[model samples]
Target: MWHMARPRKPLLSRARIVACALALVDDEGLQAVTTRRLAAELGVRGPSLYNHFRTKDDILDAVADAVCADVDLSMFEPYTEGAEAAEGAERAGSTDGPGAADWQDALARWARSYRAALAAHPHIVPYLARGPGRRPSQLRMADAVFGALTAAGWSRAQATHIGATMRYFVAGSALGSFARGFVDDAELYARDYPHLDEAHLLAEYQQRVDDGAFETGLRALLAGLAQPRDD
Candidate 1:
């Protein structure tokens, strides 16, 4: 008996293209993610990529959206619905009802999650600063943040400012590269720069330093935003 050939799998798709492109960027850098390279990675012709994405920027936008989709916005659910608020409160073991204070807590949790997402994909952090534009996932995150702030009784202007401030903080922290920037050799700092002598110690505790600084700044920002403002 003659056996028929197995059906050929689909060679290309938007999701496949995007996944390969993202992996290329993760392994190499954003600069290395050319259409030709991506096509090769997908085992297709360079022009085949155009079937899914119009240009390299389109692919990058998808990658950025993928990163944004990884962020945990569950904390903001309580702000939008009463049932979620009750559920979240019960899960957190909080006897006090969800209120403005809960909004602050949710925002803090959201901020941390957002930071972690960016930290995991440091190569994409630069592209993120360009704003959400037409990216659906990024837009959703912005909506959740703004909705939570407004629902918590903050004025539209205040909420907008707070959102901008938080984005700046998260983006800045991801771009700083503190761990890789610190010098581990004490001898690198001469007497002329005595203030840099202890810098070597920072290399051993880079994570703690970076995390502590972020938390401190985030707390201060939240505290300030929580206060009454003339505006």
Candidate 2:
């Protein structure tokens, strides 16, 4: 007698599951994305998820990694190929001492890319404060920061400190943006306070704006980092 073949495993993999989890957080918020909930959505039992991921934290880490992957690392490079090639051409044509270069612009670009990505995945911003593993992607990001600082003539130690300070500020600001109500509940507050009503905190008609708070803090942090350390 021939036995019926078992159903092939679903095409779903761990990464897909993590992506689904990210969407759950993005749409319904993080509290809605428990392992049991995800398993049901995936058409698998709760324990089945453990076959792909050992624990809830493991799934969370994968989600953070997935979000961070959205940032473009090449743009964080100290000099893009085009910039480097142009510099080479400039050296060939002129006898100038050296072109004025500022690594702050590159670092600012890196911070902007980081803030934009993390703000989009606000739930995952916390994990970045804990730092990434010693993987190739993580190393590349670290290298990019270091490369930018070194190009501006900072020592290794100074560059490391500068990179850490920038990362912390970006992650912290993203968390703040996420806490601001998706639809600000100004109406509730306005009922009690006249000033709140006058300010129209819930005004959606205004053009969407970032308030530039993140960039402002970034500049402040850089100013501090550029100062001479007492120790």
Best by lDDT: 1
Compared with the true structure, what per-residue lDDT tens digits does model 1 show for residues 109-133? 9989999999888888888899999
Model 2 gets an lDDT of: 0.70
lDDT of 2 by residue, 142-224 (tens): 77777666555566788888888888877887776432443566676667775656444534532243445565677787676
Per-prediction TM-score: 0.86, 0.69
Pairing residues by index, what is the TM-score of model 1? Answer: 0.86
Worst 10 residues of 1 by lDDT: 95-104
The true-structure Cα RMSD of candidate 2 reads 5.9
Q: Superposing all C-alpha atoms, what RMSD in Å does each candidate have to the true structure?
A: 5.3, 5.9
Following a full C-alpha superposition, what root-mean-square deviation does model 1 have from the true structure? Answer: 5.3
What is candidate 2's TM-score against the reference? Answer: 0.69
Count of backbone clashes, every candidate in sequence: 0, 0
Clashes of 1: 0
